[model samples]
Target: MYQVYYTRDKAGRITQKLETIEGITHSIDYSYDLAGRLIEVKQDGTVTETYQYDANGNRLNNAQYSKCTTK
Candidate 1:
């Protein structure tokens, strides 16, 4: 089994997530614009994803996700 922990802002936006698997844990931090639109994700303190949107709330482009490394 796995475990997931989340931190949400008062605006009901998930600001962070910590997931555990096989007793190992990894965390991702979320960022948003003032309007609460998702903008970026930092996995283990390095950005691994990005997002963009249009004024009409349509996704302008595909988000990027890649393996995160710790050095």
Candidate 2:
């Protein structure tokens, strides 16, 4: 069985997650902007994802995946 652990902020938001499997450990970290919007994601201390939002809180694009279009 694998083991997983999480670290949270004062507000109970998960700030970091650690997992161990087969004697290998991996970590993921979460970051938020001032407005509490998720802005970045890191895996093993390397940035693997990024996010951008519009003024109205609409997701504009995701750096790791695809872009969003407005109709």
Candidate 3:
């Protein structure tokens, strides 16, 4: 069986998600901008991925985001 848990900040934004399966625990942490847009994803306190957007909130291409694990 698997279990999941979530944590939220006072501003009501999701801050973390944790999942447990077969005695192994995995987690993902979240960050947001003042506008509440998701900005970064981390594991074990290391940033592994990021997101980009135009000023109007349109998703932007991240050709410069070298940290992305998948192309």
Candidate 4:
């Protein structure tokens, strides 16, 4: 079996996750807006996905990026 670890924010949100197998490790990170909404996702320290929300707490759109792009 592999091992997985997680880091969380003060509000108990999952901020990062790491998994290791066969001496290789992979990591994913998450970011949240002030309202505790998911705003971004990163892999290996590079932004890979993003989310936008309207004022009503609804998801506006989701975007996936090739390489690291900032918006």
Candidate with the larger TM-score of 1 and 4: 4
Report the C-alpha lDDT of model 3 over 7-50, residue by residue, as the tens digit.
99998888998989998888889989888888888875677678
Question: Which one is best on TM-score?
Answer: 4
Which is better, 1 or 3, measured by lDDT?
A: 1
Q: List the global CA lDDT of all models.
A: 0.88, 0.89, 0.80, 0.94
How far is 48's C-alpha from truth in model 2 (Å)? 0.3
Question: For model 4, what is the alpha-carbon lDDT of residue 45?
Answer: 88
**Deviation from native of the Cα of residue 6 in model 3, angstroms:** 0.2
Extract clashing residue pairs from model 4: none
Best model per lDDT: 4
In model 2, pairs of residues that clash are none
Question: Candidate 4 regions off by >4 Å?
Answer: 67-71
Tell me the lDDT of candidate 2. 0.89
Predicted candidate 1 versus true structure: per-residue lDDT over 1-71, tens digit per residue: 69999999999899999999999988999999877888899988888888899898776875777774599
Error of 3 at 62 (Å): 5.1
- Comparing 2 with 3 on TM-score, the higher-scoring candidate is 2
* Candidate 2, superposed: residue stretches over 4 Å from native: 65-71
Ranking by lDDT: 4, 2, 1, 3
Angstrom error of the Cα, residue 57, model 1: value is: 3.2
TM-score of 3: 0.74
